[model samples]
Target: MADDIREMSFEQAIAELEQVVGQLDSGDVPLERSIDLYDRGAKLKAHCEVKLREAEEKVEQITLDAKGQPTGTRPAEGM
Candidate 1:
């Protein structure tokens, strides 16, 4: 589970998180399983956040020329 979760792409993490939310929302999961799902959900949420922040930083670092076209990328700062 550790390797699999850590390796999941952003999309995969998000989709699994949504499914975990659905199961928890339905109130049909056993208490024990719900607790386990909640833990996984927390990890997934953190992973998603990290992925989003990395993407945001990349977007921020795009160097633009006078015409506002992307010239290239700059080094991301304050990472």
Candidate 2:
């Protein structure tokens, strides 16, 4: 399970986070288990946030034409 969590992609992380929330909401887990799940969920949330920010930065770096569309030029090539 630990290995799977470590290997989770951004979408998988978000899905697990959502499942954690559902578990917490159901009030089925013991207090200690709830806390542990919350901690893991927080970490997953942070990882997802970082991934989203990186994707946003990449989008911003893309040059758009006057019509607000990508010009298809690779921006990093010039760097």
Candidate 2's displacement at residue 76, Å, is 14
Badly placed stretches (over 4 Å) of model 1 are 61-79
Candidate 2 residue runs with Cα over 4 Å from true position: 1-6, 61-79
- Tens-place lDDT per residue, model 2, 1-79, is 3556667798999998999999999999999999999988888888888777767656535678999998765435422
Model 1 C-alpha lDDT per residue in residues 1-79, reported as the tens digit of each score:
4677889999999999999999999999999999999999999999999898888777658799999999988877775
TM-score of each: 0.75, 0.69
lDDT of each: 0.90, 0.81
